[model samples]
Target: MVDLMEHAGANPGRGTYGMAMAASRTVFEARRDCAALLGVKDPRDLFFVSGCTEACNLMLKGLLQPGDRVVVSSMEHNAVTRPLHVLSGRGVRVDFVTADTAGLVDAEAFERAVAEAPTRAIVCQHASNVTGTIQPIGDLADIAHAAGALMLVDGAQGAGHLDVDVAALDVDAYACSGHKALLGPQGIGVLYLRSGLDAMQLVEGGTGASGADEPGQPLDRPERYEAGTPNTPGIAGLGAAARYQSAHGAGIRATERRLTVRLREALSAMDDVVLLGPAPHDESVPVVSFTSPRAEPDRIAFELDRRFGIAVRSGLHCAPWAHRTIGTLDTGALRIGIGHGTTDADIDALLAGLDEVLA
Candidate 1:
């Protein structure tokens, strides 16, 4: 693993004053590479933010006007919901689309919601953080566009786990965190804004350009969205991480699919186990979750960690609506988010731990 973030921050774009000028170039390149991964045609549309939360907040607050309604799926992360809630406090209304028993959103329901008058945006998670259920973004985009709403997808979980094409998906705006599946350093993330769509500025400050003006921000493509100093060191690490993942995506997805399928099959066959998400779709990646009748999720996770040395996340996963769809909201479920580095032996070890605990 190349760990650039672990090192001290490098000052970029500095002058004789040792100012941090190189950092701007570092983030600029990182934004470009991330835009490529996101299937964006113009790299200038990519903006680097503090993380996915800031990106989501930027898109949500910038895109919607007062009294405009936004539609989001039940599976959105708190990053999406929390901002929307704040917007609601300011008189913006939010409507929720329904997810199926498998925790995937119903494309028809999404269409219906967007078709309603006053719906300005339709937001959804590309993949559920808790259930790992992949949303049908391409189809959902069709519905959103047909209903005259722009699609805003939270790619926090999908960006690193799967191939994301903002153009093909027809999403107007998308946000992704660098730290999760991308294996990049925290404090760096990318937001892709569709061409021709003007996102309202949430804040204004120094953009390292147009010093001749009265200190107002530039109206340029990315500079309009980016205000103040960029995260150069984190962005450098992010650029390297994108290159690394691009080269290894195929092999990593292959390994994840194999291990996840094997684990899902074994768990699905158990007496008390119930797996979530699509039924092993051929193209799906392995980020499996399950509920056990004999053991609560947190307890099972604790047993796996303390006694079996297996790490897993257990809770509502910040998507209560997703858990509610799968009837796991009250108690939550065990989420085993497998990464490129996970192995067959790891799955087998987890299974053995479950057996011992459930038995």
Candidate 2:
């Protein structure tokens, strides 16, 4: 990979200070490139935040008023739902856009939710954290626009796993974490905002630029949203990660699908094992979730870790609505997420462990 960098325009020898400056610039360009990847035109419209959680809070606080109503799907991550729930405590009216049993947001229902008067914004997750069920963002964006509402999409699980076009989708805001699919370090995230969209700053501090005001925060891209000192190392790594994804993302997507389909087929073949979310798992990412009739989700997770050295996530995944939709509300479901680096051997390891547990 280091040898490949010579041709890629990223030099490791660019000194610590030079590298730091490069990362700052890369962070700016990454926001643009990521926006382009998501189908948004201007890079200046994007903001680099701490992570998806802060991005959600920024949108929620920046867009909504005291009496405004906000709509969110039941399948959204706590990053999206929890912030709105907090706002509801402050007298903001928050309504839910229902999801089907498979954990998908009903497009019509979401549209209707946005149509109601006094609705300030519609927040939706691009995919479910627990079930990996994909939503209809383009159509939902259309509906939200028709209702004069801004659409905020949580892309924590979708940005790297799936294709997104912000301009075509007509979304007002899209938030994503850098670690998950983009393969960057933790504490870095990208938020794409449509031109002319103004989100209130969640915090006010030093942005390292344009701080003549007494309150001390620049009202500009990458500055207005970024307070205090930025994470230069993580941002540099993120630039590398973005370049990696751009070069190999298509192949990664195909590989994840192939592995996920094989694993899903194997899970479906098990007699007592029940697959959760969509059947055939077509529109979702490389996430496969299920429950066993004989065991609890937590025990299943523990057994996989202790007995087979397999790492998988369990519990509600902070998306309670998705767990409820899949009939795993009480116990949640065992989840396996296949990333770009996941291999066939990894899938086989999980399958063999699951089969052993069921037996």
The TM-scores, one per candidate, come to 0.92, 0.91
For each of the candidates, the C-alpha root-mean-square deviation to the true structure, in angstroms, is 2.5, 3.8
Clashes within 3 Å, all models in order: 6, 3
Assess each prediction's global lDDT (C-alpha) against the native: 0.81, 0.78
TM-score of model 2 vs. true structure? 0.91
1-359 per-residue lDDT for model 2 (tens digits): 23223323342223346544454565566666666666768777877778888777887877787798888888877887788888888888988877887888888887766666667778888888887788888888888888888888898898889866777778899888889987887998878877777778787876655454656566677577777666655666676787778778899988988887888888888898998877765678778899888888789899999999988888988888667766788988889989977898988888888878877
- For model 2 the local lDDT of residue 271 reads 94
lDDT of 1 at 260: 72
Alpha carbon lDDT at 29, candidate 1: 71
Query: Which candidate leads the pack in lDDT?
Result: 1
